[model samples]
Target: MSSASRRRPWDVHRLPSAEGSTFLVTGGNAGIGYFTAEQLAATGAHVVLGSRDRAKADTAMASIRSRVPDAHLSHLPLDLADLASLKSVADRLDLDHLDAVVHNAGVALDDPPRRETGDGHELMFGTNHLGHFALTQWLAPLLSAAPAGRVVTVGSFAARSERLDLDDLQSTLDYRPKRTYGRSKLAQMSFGFELDRRLRAINSTVLSVVAHPGGALDSLTPSRPPVSVTTAAERLRALPAALLVQGKDAGARPVVRAVLDPEVRGGQLWGPRVFGLRGTPRCEPVPAHMADAEVAARLWAASGELTGTDPDLGFR
Candidate 1:
């Protein structure tokens, strides 16, 4: 068969049944994360939304249930900024095995002199990068035995233009909010790629894949009552940009595809089909700089020490 014909068509609305599986989506209480959980839950998977606030999670879950009456969903109190609490959170998760974990949670300070986490690390890097690093290490046990399991790290298109400065990962010397945030995301994407290689070396069945939403605008997102409200004025104001960007609902496509598409492989980078900004999920080439093994290795080493989890021995 020809290459085009061999490719399986995907319908985001008509997901394959995953009745016996379970998924965890960090920051699943809102935005792209909420839509990710909602779509996965529609497939009959027991999806747990990892959020710092129980009330917000409830609102998001209720919105999801409003759309999917029989959806199996729950909440897990997760505070990525607090490194000490992650273990307890992992222990609290009552599941035999996890089919996938979407590292969709993140923090971005629009403008700041600089901020640090409770752990003394840069806020963005600590929460967005190291937090997920340690969480995955801790979640390894539940993922280890599941051959079809995946770890989907949600990266950012903004990270595409940024580079990592290994010496000042915490931005102690220099910290611009946007730059630091981009670097944090780059670090996370690098970690995802590194983890894929390490998992393969260890003969682990768990696969790692990275994805990014091109440009999802809040104004373009559909209103889901208390969960998300896109006012008419906001929609009208954002109308012109709709041609270039997409909604959080559409932005959720790539990660959802990464989680369930059998054809998607580890080390692959998926993004929007158009200009890496907005469209259906499409498998794309991994940019060379983004896939630099040496840089990822160094970041990996530093991450283990910083998080105090030492993923080398922590991840099963």
Candidate 2:
């Protein structure tokens, strides 16, 4: 493998011109999502920042425009935890063509209290996996209309730590904050690769790929949103991690690579080349559990049932 560097082959600076492409990034209001939008907008892609809060979405677009003065930017309010909100947002998009959708929004709460989404599913699983699943379902037509459009779902390296319980997809059987987060991410990866397989089987042009922002932290991340300021205690906790962590800018590379890298194919997973923590983007191996066909099928069916939205392959 090649060495990671300030200017690797997959560096965002080398990103090809996306002048005519349009990308919608979920959770674009902050963190890795924001940086992904910023980089894409800087590369001349028309970027729509998707968030639950309009104010935050506006602020995020403003921040991006400050750096990329000529950026083509927009915002669409989307609360992934709520199925109704997802439908409303999809209706508003009304796009006939979209180059890509970055499924980056996730429940970022640390040790969040046990909770459920509007539809009564576990919050993390509902938001991270099912929400994107439904959103992708609604937007499949628009994506298929585009020339070689792709869906890049942002997964997590933390997923490698845990296997999912398909029988208890919602974690109702045994709920632990950290473990639930990992399972939700694993579900996201499963859905992404499985979607790719189904799309291929159906001869659909749209592609699905997964990428992870390995070990990126807000503390070391520059241009962080004002609302994202870390407290003293938070900073203290991240001190050790700071040694291995990269900023959001660097972390966003894998995702950007997955989205726009012409050589990349559907079902490929990308992540940091070194230590799976901090480095340039490279095609990484999918976790064994994440690639399980039976698990993916079960999760897909469960997700459709939970969200009340089935995957539409743009078929009539």
Candidate 3:
């Protein structure tokens, strides 16, 4: 809990050499996802950008190519808000194996009054948690095929403030947009930890880890009118606050570290190690309650019911 300068003395400039590896990063077209893809592609890895918008994806890919002329990159359509879209992308993905899968796609719709997705679940919960749940489940075979694959699920410190309501997971009972967003993130974090447990139980080699940008002060969350406007302005006006907010490059560090670091253990949480929630990357501990077995099992069951997908797949 002590706050100190956690900056690594190592040269952060040298790009991660993921040559000979393949990676699929959801929402890799912009913001933190874009930077993550750019860094990975710079290392000669075969990077596929999973994006919902084709035009935006193409633009992001083009921008990356402009910077790193030799970046081995491509784009694939993936809309986390729609299960059908996720299934389609999963079906079309031809990779026999993947070194890492970065579950970076997420949304934070603050429209209020509880909006439901096409799947009829709360928009934020459905897109951020259930979508990734199904996507990861679908990609299990490919991940298992790798020598030692890694699944990096992006979460947020906002999760710390979340208290999952099992009875009304979709926020149907009492939907506060921001609270629901935090709750959904908590679910994602819980899923990451729980998935690691299940993976080990099944004797799978795929490593499951979670990471957060601390408070990057970026637009990682979906924009919704006043809440978005006010939040953005507050973030911008607070320059000292930005000191706690890592840049996209630095923000992407925990994900990279969790995904690529051989020392990273399954179920570990990585984030900045300073106040304002910004600093060099370091492994941190999630709350004990977040890893509660009963809560995870319940959430897993609820997710399966919502998405119509099985959580337990025999992958020994």
Candidate 4:
């Protein structure tokens, strides 16, 4: 069979049944995260919606139930920007064994000026990179206990903008919104790949994977319980871009694939098949810098230092 035919076709409707599984999705209250949770719950998995606002999470939960009446759903208050909140939520998580944890929450392009959270860390870097780092480490025990646990950290096409700088991870030296966002995503991808290497070195079953949603448009996506009430100005801004992008449900395909596709190996990155914007999920090559073992190790070490939490890789 040709390489094309050897590739398995991935679609939201055809996901492997998630019965008897449990998954946690950060920022699952809106956008692509919400769609991912809805899809997983539809397949009989119990989904824990992690969000900063309980009300928004409740709204997202109601939205999921409206579509999938039997959807098994729970909510956990998680604010990735705040380490205290992240640890509190992580401690509160009662799952015995988590099948997967989708790190899908972060600051988007429209967010305000670069600012530090209460922890004195940049908002995007703290939430997108350091926040997930600490949470994953705290949850490592639960994950290791699972038969085949997986952690899926979301990345972005913007990561191609600038190479990661260990000293300027927060972009304090020079902070451009676009570049800062890209740097955070680069850190996320690097840490994810490095995590896979460490897990493999220790012969652990937990797999670390990275995925990007490509481009998704809020104007084109249907708002169920209304995670955020889109203003007229925002919708107008999204109009032109909406034509070139996919809806939230379609954008979520890559993340779901990364979580459920049995063939997906650790250290592999998945994204849209068409120009990194919108299409079916497919394995994509990680950027040369992002794939570098040395860079990944540096970021991993930096993450541990910044988060003050060392990863528990089931080895001394």
The candidate scoring highest on lDDT is 1
Sort the candidates on lDDT, descending order. Answer: 1, 2, 4, 3
Q: How far is candidate 1 from the true structure (C-alpha RMSD, Å)?
A: 1.6
**Whole-structure CA lDDT of model 3:** 0.80
What are the models' TM-scores?
A: 0.96, 0.91, 0.88, 0.90
Error of 2 at 133 (Å): 0.7
Give the alpha carbon lDDT tens digit for every residue of 29-129 in model 3: 87678777877887789999998788888878887787789988888888887887766665687878888899988887767667778878788899999
- Per residue, candidate 2 scores C-alpha lDDT tens digits across 1-316 of 4344543465567788889899999999888999999899988989999998998888888888888999999988788888876666656987778899999999844675788987898999989988899888778778888998899999998999889887888878788898999889989999899998898888888889999999898766664556366667766777787667787778999999988888799999999878888888999888788889888888887777777785453432
Off by over 4 Å in 4: 1-9, 88-90, 109-112, 228-243, 311-316
The lowest-lDDT stretch of 10 consecutive residues in candidate 4 is: 307-316
The per-residue C-alpha lDDT of model 1 at residue 40 equals 91
TM-score of 4: 0.90
Candidates, ranked, TM-score = 1, 2, 4, 3
Question: Per-residue CA lDDT of candidate 4, range 1-316, in tens?
Answer: 8987997676667787888888999999988899999888888899999988898899899988988999999998888877766656546888778889999899855554779888999888998999998888777877887889999998887887679878788878888887888888888888888888888888888999999988887766665646645557876777788656777778888999999888899999998888888888999988898889998887877777888885553322
Of candidates 4 and 3, the better by TM-score: 4
Query: What TM-score does candidate 3 get on C-alpha atoms?
Result: 0.88
lDDT measured at residue 104 in model 1 versus the true structure, 0 to 100:
94
Clashing pairs in 3: none
- lDDT, candidate 1, equals 0.92
Which residue pairs clash in candidate 1?
none
